[model samples]
Structures are given as structure tokens and as C-alpha cells.
Target: MFKIMIVEDDHKIREIMLENIKKWGFDGLYIEDFNEVFNVFLKYEPHLVLMDINLPSFDGFHWCNKIRALSKVPIVFISSRDTNMDIIMAMNMGGDDFVQKPFSIEVLMAKVNAILRRTYSYSNVETDVIEHDGAVLNLKDSNLIYNEKKLELTKNEFKIIYLLMKNSGKVVSRDKIMRSLWEDESFVDDNTLTVNINRLRKKLAGIGLSEFIETKKGQGYIII
Candidate 1:
């Protein structure tokens, strides 16, 4: 099922949209920390977003611009401030569509499904493999291919590597890394995360991609 990110801070609207999203056979994730909305976007990698114009920290336009930098995902703005200027501004800010406040959940769902169908139905496929130097990560199958060798990875290992490769050239802090790994409860200490990172690196180096990841002092780890 496709995942939808709900950035509406209003409790009632958020629940309405979430319920309809599930009913429509899509997954839903509600934003908890408005300050780290972009982080949520990266971690969830939702196919689309339902956003409100006003929010706790940053507005929908600001988050839209940031998301556009990382993804081509669709965004639909939901708000009570309905006006020509609001619609115009929303579109200019990279939003795909807009829904005024007090909308029927049915109508909202229709718009959401239509936008997703349009976006995904006509796009050319990106290369399944991401390559650097001679090493490649087969995104389709979670396999590492390098120097005439293929390395298999567990689900957790694949997720770790995917995050590293996706954000290559930047140090990913331990907290962020752990958040991606463990979405709730079960706190993973820094030492355990380090061990897993080491194991993953060795698996990569066993074939050819040694020095694939680097430890940034007091920062975190990164693959570059």
C-alpha cells in the first residue's frame, strides 16, 4: 500500500484524513514533531503528503520547498484559509493540489487518489541501481554489487546502507540513524549501533568497497 504523510496539526482533520487513507487502502503517518517534518519525510518516504498551511514551527510552503529538494513526491495542501492567493502560493510552493477546510473526507480522498495515480502512472523509472566509483547498490533488491561480486544483506543491514547511500557526503548523527532503525521504544545505544555499522562495512569491504563509510568525529557516520 502507498504511504501518505499527514502534516495537519489539527487533531480532528488529521484523524478524518487518516481514517479515510486507511479505508482507501493506503498507509498513513501523522507528523508529531513539526520541527523535524523533513526528517519524517525522509524516513517514511511517503508517496504523497496532506499538509496544512499553518503549523507549529514551519508552514507548509517551507516544508514543501525542503521536500522538493530531496524528493519528487506529491503534496496536497489542506487549510481553512482558502483564497485565490492561497491557492496560487500553494502551487508555486511545489504543492500538487489544494483542499479548503471543512471538506468532505470523501472528496479529499478522491483528490489524493487522483493525484497519486497521475504522478506514478506516467513517470519514467529511475535506474534501480545507484553506483559510485565501481560499487553499486541495487535498490530494487537490496543487494550490493561490486567488482564482479554480489553481497546479500538482511533487512536491517539494507536499511542502514540505504540511508547511508541516500545521504552520502554527510555525517548522519547516531540519534537519526537509530530513529530510522528503531521507530519506537527499544533504545539502541551508541555502542551497539557502532558494532552494526562495523559489521555492515566489513560485508561491503569483503567484496571490494572498502572505506565505503567514514566515522565523523562527534558527528556520526556517512558513506561518501
Candidate 2:
């Protein structure tokens, strides 16, 4: 089932959207903290978004742009403002579609299903898999597989392995590794980097791949 994240702040509208979304066989999530919308979005990784123009902190356009940076997931703007400028700005802000407020739930469902079909039907094949030794990292699902054992990885861990495995035998710089993490991890100190790397290594070790990620001391890490 496709997951639909609703970023609408109106309590009644959000509740109705959630109920109708579930009834139509989709997983619906309503954002509680407007300021943490992007964080919640990264965690949920929804297939599509229903966004509102006026929100508590950042408007829907701001959040849509942030999501666009991290993902190509479809974002459909649902707003009361029906001006041509609003529609144009929504599209420019990476909105897949715009639904004016006071829409029928059935029409919304139809649009959601249509976008899903268009996006996934012809392009459901998984991409971005990197392999080093016998270990394979699936960037799509953020998981690692080695010797037929599958290990789930957090977003940070996946980015680390992706960078290392993409450059396989080369030493990826610590600074580069830190920069690769999705959000504000660039400001994190060295010890935090060490902790994340160690945790990732331990997870790999648990799956019997102890020497998968090699450290280059004062330099960085390499996958060989």
C-alpha cells in the first residue's frame, strides 16, 4: 500500500483526509510538528504528500522544496488559495499537482492513484545498488546484503556505505563522509562520525563481514 503524508494543519481537514485515505487502501500520516516536517518525511519516506499553503512555521512551498532536495517523491499541494500565481509557484516549488481546497475525497483519491500509476507503473525497477566484495548495498531500501544475509541500515549508515562502496578501493575522506549525511550532520564533530562508522561496522560484523569497511587512520574509510 502506498503511504500518503498529509501536511495540512487544519485539524478537521486532516482528520477527514486520513480517514478517507485509509478507506481507499492507503497509509495516511498527518504531520504534528510543522517545524519537524522534513525530519518526519525522511523517516516515513511516503510515496506522496498532501500539503497546505498556510502552515504553522514554514509554508508548504518551503517544505516542498526541502523534500525535493532529498527525494523525487510526488508532492501535491492542497490549498485554499486558488490564484494562478499560487498554482505556478507550487509547480515551480516541485509540486506534482495542485488540488484546490473543498475537494471531494473521491477526486483526491483518483488523483493520488493516477500519479502513483504514472510514476511507478513504468519504472518500478530498483536502482542505486553498490557492491564491494560480497556485500551489496541497496540505496533504495537502505539495506545491506552479504552472503545471503540481509541487514537493515539507518539513513546515515546507508549514505556512508554508499559513498565508500561507490569509490570501492579509494579512501573516502572523513569530511566527505560527514557531508554526505542528509541533513545538518555536517556540523557534527569527529567523535560523532566515529560513532556512526563504528555502529555501521558492528552491524556489518554481526552479519559476518567484519573487515568490510577499513579505516585509514587519520585519513578516512575505504571499502575493499
Candidate 3:
């Protein structure tokens, strides 16, 4: 069974989360030590994490960053802060989704199932959907689609797209992309980065997303 980790402080809410998670048939664990949240994370190696924004010492974003450092396990924020900034912050902090306070149990479970299905299914499921106007990057099959056209992407192409798409309009430095793609390598030349960007752009154009990638001169690139 898939394992889920919950990092909520409130006892009643924690119990509710545990019960709901168990009802979905997935094994779940609650963080007992607020200080060593990451320890429970490592011990469980959960497929997903449910984090609350408010904690004893650290906020959910800090925990999310720590977990991201260790694993790419999907993290979803369950918080009472329903502001737009909160949601955006959650996404920017590596959270896959957000559940506001006073949310329906059924809806919460549905979201959990949706995340689990898209994340861990046996089929060629996508890592996520990167939306840019009419264009969408299919993370699973490494396909870029727009106006009914489909462009297949290579491993590097997919990685670049994933990173840029995650950031969207934000300028993603070439170094950032390189770090994600060639982590073990200390150096990746400018030509390599340019080539990857060119290839990705061409593939996107084939799918009618031409001019979708914006160059920022000395900065980097973005899907605007």
C-alpha cells in the first residue's frame, strides 16, 4: 500500500486526516515530533506528504524544502490560509496541491486519490500538466501539445520543459536547468544549454506554441 505522512499539529484534525487517509486504503503516519518532522518523513518514506502551514518551529514551506532536498515525494499543503498568496506560495514551495481549512472530507479524499492516481499509477501517467495559454506539456509521455499538434521531447527536452513549465513566466536560468539535468556534472557548456533550449523550442513550435519560449538575453528562458 502507498504510505502517506501527515504533519498537522492539531490532534482532532490529525485524527481526522489519519482516519480519512486510512479510509482510502493507504497506510498513513502522523508526525509526533514537531522538531524532527523530517525524521518521520525518512522513516516512512511516504509516497506523499500533507503539511500544515503553521507548525511549532518551522512553517510548512521549510518542511517542504527539506523534503524536496531528500526526495521528490509530492507534498500537498493543508492550511487555513486560503489567500491567493498562500496558494501561490504553496506551489512555489514544491507543493503539488493545496487544501484549505473547513474543507469537505469527501473532497479532501478525492484530491488525495487524484494525486495518488496521477503520481503513482502503473500507466504512463504524467508528472504534471504545465499549462501555458493553449499549450500543455504532458509530463508522462514527454509531449508538448497545442492546437491539436503534438511534439515529442527527448530526455533533456523533457527535463528543460518540466523545470521551465514549473516556473512558467519566471526566468529560469540556464544554470538552474543544467543543475536539474546534469547534477553529477560540475560543468555544462553554454552550447549544450542553447542546444537543449533550441530543441525544446522547435518541438514546441511543431505543436503550435511558437514564440512561446521567451529569451531574456543575459538572464534565461521562460514560457510566456
State which candidate has the highest lDDT. Answer: 2
Ranking by TM-score: 3, 2, 1
Top TM-score model: 3
For each candidate, what is the lDDT?
0.81, 0.84, 0.80
The number of residue pairs in model 2 that clash at the backbone is 0
Q: Model 3 off-target regions past 4 Å?
A: 122-224
Task: Give lDDT for model 2.
Answer: 0.84
lDDT, model 3: 0.80
Provide TM-scores for the models: 0.54, 0.54, 0.55
Better of 1 and 3 by lDDT: 1
Q: Please provide the root mean square deviation of candidate 2 (C-alpha atoms, Å).
A: 17.7
Residues 1-224, candidate 1: write the lDDT tens digits.
68999999998889888887886668998998899999999999999999999999789999999998888899999999978999999999888988788765545665675577677873442334555544667677888776558889887788888888768788898788888888852666667788788899899889977788888888988877
Q: How many collisions per candidate?
A: 0, 0, 1
lDDT per residue, candidate 3, 1-224, as tens digits? 88999999989998999997886677998988899998888878999898999999998999999998879888989999988999999999899988888665555655666678778883543324555554666666887666556777889988888888778879998778888889754676769888888887776677667788899999988876
Q: After superposition, how far is residue 12 of candidate 3 from its true place, in Å?
A: 0.4
